[model samples]
Target: MSSYVEGALVEGERIVHAGRISAWALWHLIGLGIILLPAFGIGLVFLIIAYVRYQSTELAVTTKRVIVKHGFIRRQTVEINLSKVESIQVDQGVLGRMLNFGTLIVAGTGTSHAPLAGIADPMAFRKAFIEAQDEGQEGI
Candidate 1:
């Protein structure tokens, strides 16, 4: 759990699920490693980029809202109330479907859609969000 995410939680808001960055995001690093096998130093840069991306990005579904954070130095955060969430659209290509990783597009009441790519177990994340949303609606 990242401090940025923990600090963003409101009163009584508990995390229902925490989505992870998919291993698929490291594909670029793998390819670079192979191509730059002789020059290991260059390959290391790509590996670091993948690691930073995987570690800095955070996704969580809470009792009150859904939260997403990206980047390390220049941060970007998105929060949508459960009541305002219209739907979660998932995009999984053949490779993604086989590897069980995909993109999750969270559409709010308006025209805004937050598309998170290279997420692990996106379906499970979506299910957890929907369940939380349903429970919140029932409690209202």
Candidate 2:
């Protein structure tokens, strides 16, 4: 099977985060469940946004680079090269730790945009990603 991978920059890195389409439900769970808006009309507008985010989140890492693609109708993509990466860190909350899901922070050597954001399985990914970055630099 083949998936349309967005143009990215990664090398020997496992997917740190790839959100499921079901993330839409999370918005409602928050906007509606927690906020408990009396009128569903205005708040519903933001709900649509949350739904879109639920659908848009797609963070991945491959053998070449880091890829971030989001947005529903209009899509936005960001790619970061491993060599430009200055450091990698894993962030986990109580829930994220138990679920094997957390955010991966990629610190760039130069610009912050060079880093990938909000990726899952940050701990495992950082190790492999750093190794790949080292290898790539060593090669050059």
Candidate 3:
């Protein structure tokens, strides 16, 4: 769990699902790194970038809301309450379908729409969100 998500949690909130960045999303970087590995180790830079990006991003669905944190130094965070989310859309290409990774677009009540790319198992994330939303509604 990332510090941002841990600290952002309110009373009685618990994470129901935690999403991750799939290595398949960094295929280009990994491929370039491998191809350039013999050229004075320049490939290491690409690999490092991929690693940093994968490590820095955090995605989770909680009992109350959906939380996403991106970036290592400069940060970007998105939070949408379960009651406020209007829809969760998943986009997956052929390769993404094969690898089980895709993008998630979360549309909330009002004017908020968050697009989260390079997410692993986007369908699972959407399913989790829906389940959580249903549970929240039941408690109301």
Candidate 4:
């Protein structure tokens, strides 16, 4: 792990949180292993680089917002509050459709910076995020 989130907090009895990219990016690694690794060492190096990048990237979700943290030196992290979310969408590809992995895009009510992407189990994530927000609101 990055050791950045050596410890963190999660709330509620049914804390449904967004799934991470580290969960579903194995396909990319597998492709590297099967097709590129031994045949082309340079390609293998790049594949390993990509795997490192993917592993570094994470999707953290809480009741208040969705957080996307990634990048090595830069460590770009984006958090969007539930109140700003106008809509949540899921994008599933062929393998994703079969495996139930997809990207979740959250549209903001006003001036969205960038939509979230490369998430696994996007529908579940969306439901969990909304439910957590609702639960948080209800508890207040």
Number of the predicted model whose TM-score against the real structure is largest:
3
lDDT-better candidate, 1 vs 2: 1
lDDT of 1 at 95: 93
Better of 1 and 3 by lDDT: 3
* lDDT value, candidate 4, whole model: 0.67
Each model's Cα RMSD:
1.4, 5.0, 1.3, 3.6
Deviation (Å) of 132 in candidate 3: 0.4
| Residue pairs of candidate 1 with colliding backbone atoms | none
lDDT (10s digit) by residue, model 3, range 1-140: 54788889999999999999888999999999999989999999998988998999999999999999999999999999999999999999999999999999999998889999999999999999999999999999
User: What's the CA error at residue 87 for candidate 2, in Å?
Assistant: 1.0
Quote model 3's TM-score: 0.95
| Per-residue accuracy of model 1 over 1-140 as CA lDDT, tens digit each | 54677899988999999999897857878678657766947877777777888889999999999999999899999999999999899999999999989999999998989999999999999999999999999998
Deviation from native of the Cα of residue 97 in model 2, angstroms:
1.5
Provide the TM-score for each candidate, comma-separated. Answer: 0.94, 0.59, 0.95, 0.75
**Rank list by TM-score:** 3, 1, 4, 2
Model 4: per-residue Cα lDDT over 1-140, one tens digit each: 43333234345332246466634546666566657657757557757766777777766667666677778787887767767877777778888887777777778778785555666677777788778778777977
Candidate 2 lDDT, tens digit per residue, 1-140?
A: 33335334335445543433334225444566446445656666666676667657676555456666767778877667766667767667786676555666677667584333444556656676766666667878
Per-residue error for 85 in candidate 3, Å, reads 0.7
